[model samples]
Target: MKFKSNILILVLLAVFIVCSVQSVSAANSHNFTTDDNFDTKFADVVNGDTFTFKAGSYNLTSDYLINKKVNLVAENEVIINSGDYRFNFASESNGSSVKGFVFLGDSNNPKATTPIATTGPTEDITINNNTFKYVYDGVSFGRYATNNFEFTNNIIDGFLRDALNLGGGSGHGDVYIVNNIIKNNLSAKDGIAIAYKGSGNLTINNNTISNVIEAISINSFNAPDLNATVIIKNNIFDNVETVIEDPNHSEIIDSYNVFNNSGESSLTHTPKEPANIIINSTISKSSISKDGSVNYTVKITNSGNRTADNITLTITLPNSLKYVKTISKTTGDYKNNEWTITALDAGSSATLSLTLNAKSTGKQTIKSSSSYLNGNETTPKEGQTTTILSVNKLSTKITVVVAKSAILGSTSKFKITVKDKNGKVLANKNIKVKVNSKIYTGKTNSNGIATVNAKISNKGKYNVKISFAGTSDYSASSKSVQHKVTASDLKIAGVKRIGKNYIVKVKNIGDISSKSTKVAISFKTDNKPGVIQYATVKVKALKPGKTVSVLVKFYINKIYSSHKRNVIIEESKTFKEASYENNIISIRK
Candidate 1:
């Protein structure tokens, strides 16, 4: 057991020492100055290490090989003098980055050598912020299939053949050449800014090339199956023999690329017109009621020196609004919320009007913008807002008309009418009438009038109120009128029979005089229990506490022979009565 434990301890110690050594090697870094030999320092670097060089000039004795994936960084004003040979980047130097270095070439052998060249398939290579002066070729990849190469923010001057060149392989990946400045003072007829012979997607954007024989050249060795697409945009070329030379007819997409010499003999593409777009928007009404409509207008102007073509405008509406029919337009038709204009002259303007309805109530926004040439040129987003306010109901007036004076125990007729503030009659409206403690409810007729009948029981002044409850578009209202009730009640006093004639006496029991009315007397015989006989008598007038008598002739039935008979009196509509129970009297024959 002791020997086994000693073996375990030894293995643990060995593992710890090996891990420490691997950690140190992985994090290896070096700093060099002009006193160190360049070849010797480069040979000592392993993969994934960073080497920093101080500012100085170091002339290479021979070609230096970068065979490791390392980062080579230099301070400002560091110059590497390559007399005739180049710094070769081998296949093992993939994922390497070189930055902030000024490379000076041999001026005597400018056409015979390149400063930085690739010897094999090197990928994910970045060479940025470098200056190549008096070199035959700057960063050349010869006949090797390479991809994912980024060459940016570089100044290449006085190149004899090409500033940046790649080719000699069947498959090449996407290459991005951006923000580069390439020019030369010499008028070399064979000088080219960029030359790509392989097949892949090449994007050359935001680059300035001037005073070269050819700005860009793409040749796919007459192979149509490669399907290479070259996009050149936002590049300015001046004093060049040809802007682009595509010998193999590969797919080239060019836009917003400015060529200064438009009338050059060997120009391939037409110069793009310089134009600018301006958009302004407005609304007819900013605030509107619910279900109301507003007009949204968009005015597009070309504030540029050249005419703009194929301008498309789009309008975006919020969810609270519904799109209605268009009103008018100076140019172009609007369909599916989009409008297109074929052409617009310089300094000209166009207008479009659209009608929109408010579907709900809230703050709504409308946005509009214009684009041309597949978004190569665009106007800023212009917005305008409209507010949808809730509608308030209209004011209504209820007018109640009733008799000024009414007799006691009489039904008073009330005329209730409803109308709006503009005197327009409203029909089918609910009405409530309260007479003292009695309430009546009904709907108005087509003439906006409702009849309410209520009994006037008291003998003094009272109020008759008429109320109207509002609807969705109308408001509530109420009105009251003064009604004076007079006292006039008729009662039957006595009944006398003479042969077939009967005399009835009626009296006014109320304080006021009674109006002319009729009295009806009914007789019932005991022989025929279901038989009844009736006679009506007319009473002219009766003052307070005064009596009046009239004769009512009622014939008897021969078959009905009985000694007992019953006589009852009832008042007609001509006058109201205070008590009806005392109007009936019993008589015996």
Candidate 2:
């Protein structure tokens, strides 16, 4: 009986071991098991929520957009029957992600083969750790969304379509596409592993992409309307088919960036075709000063791998701006405004310095662009600013938007905007706009914007002169805009000197105005030793407010005059420097 019991215990032990092994096998095969369908779970997960799918192929319907951030995790090898952007998370939903699943976007939508069109704003999104197989548009960003997210640690077995479509719209969809295995994207339509359309500053690093029409592309809809900077550095594209090569000129700032390979190529990617051009260059400066002088430089280099013959580098000045081009590799005349350089071997560098002569002073601007023999060009409208010599460049650009009823002692509020011709917002952190006096200054808010509080005194005619102070970064500027504080006809009257004596006459011959008037004159002496002679001149009305002109003259001491030289009008006691003009004074000497 004891021997029989021992045999039974051994047999029971074996059974227990078998049962444990079976359970472990089941767990390894399926990460999570559910009895229900995947469609139901996909539809039920709220934003900022969680959803699970069992080990099976999910028959995807239409493209679903996740409004909230959620984790859409799946069992390994869980196939998405269709991958045509099956799941989208925009806006702040960038926190959302899809993990441990295979996306197959080749199948037709059960409802419609063509995706429906819907337009609006979208948020940023992130996609990672997913397998893409047999898909057309592996994934694409929409407009109005910034694509600074990543695609990493994923297996892309095949790209039946465009692997990565890098642009959507005017939105900031610039992205960092890194560390993904792109195998067989065979479609000839846009076999481009990644393509950019006006989207900018993408860092494509350490991504392995192969078997495509073109490796990378930087394309633009319109060069004049682009407003983004692109930088491409440190990426790898191995064994990619070269049906069509990108010329790299698609940026408003940087046309295209094909990042350096990790020394993977055979020291050679594609042979540079022989190219020719008489004039091709990109200037770094923006615009000319009000006096029409700008100091800036241009860069001239050979992008091709082959040596350029007779590399006579001529920067055909925009003929409109009239520039004198200069490069160290140049041979031509800087006075004549053309730089001819020696041949630049393939992959060589050259520099071109030029001085732009600005026509008018105000805020001068010009487009910065380049054209190469390989059909490479970069262009921008309203490119750079060239200040003449004033300090307050931004605040001087005043567009006095007036309403009908801005009367004396009343207040009005309006927006003051400063923009270059290219529609670029100029940076003016130190601009102040004052109305009436410094008591009503708008300096703490925005640039070139001044809030005004009007309190017109003796208002026969009132004028608003907006003066702009210069920052350390720019020059100063001022513009006088006219506004009437009164509803009646107002005219300016003047009084003649009292036969060049120490007396002056005053008169108001046009309309009935106030008795007190602010009189000013300019002196050539720049010395602040109180040169302005200030005294109240009262004139009883002769008729229609007219006073004797005999006592309106001012005289200086003979001893001071004997030594004083070139003492022309600088400013008077009642006048500020901003209110003075060139023709407002005369030299008596």
Among these predictions, the greatest lDDT belongs to: 1
Residue-wise C-alpha lDDT for candidate 1, range 1-589, written one tens digit per residue:
9999999999999999999987765636788799998778887788898888899997878888899888888887889887787888998999999898888886766775577888898788988999998888888887776688888899998788888887547647888889999988343558778978667788898999988888887773334345568888788888777777776677787776778862252333535455566878887886765556888888888776677778788887877677898888899778998888888787889998888887655567677767764223554323233333343456788888888988887788888889887687889998988878888887889999988888767777887778997875677899988988887667677878788777878788777887776766565555666777656776787889999888877665544445455455444454555655676666765
Local distance difference test, each candidate: 0.76, 0.46
> lDDT for model 2, on a 0 to 1 scale?
0.46
For model 2, give the RMSD to the true fold.
28.5
- Total clashing pairs for each candidate: 0, 38
After TM-score superposition, what is the CA distance of residue 310 in candidate 1 from its true location, in Å?
A: 17
lDDT of 2 by residue, 36-61 (tens): 54455455444566555567876655
Q: What TM-score does each of the candidates earn? A: 0.45, 0.34
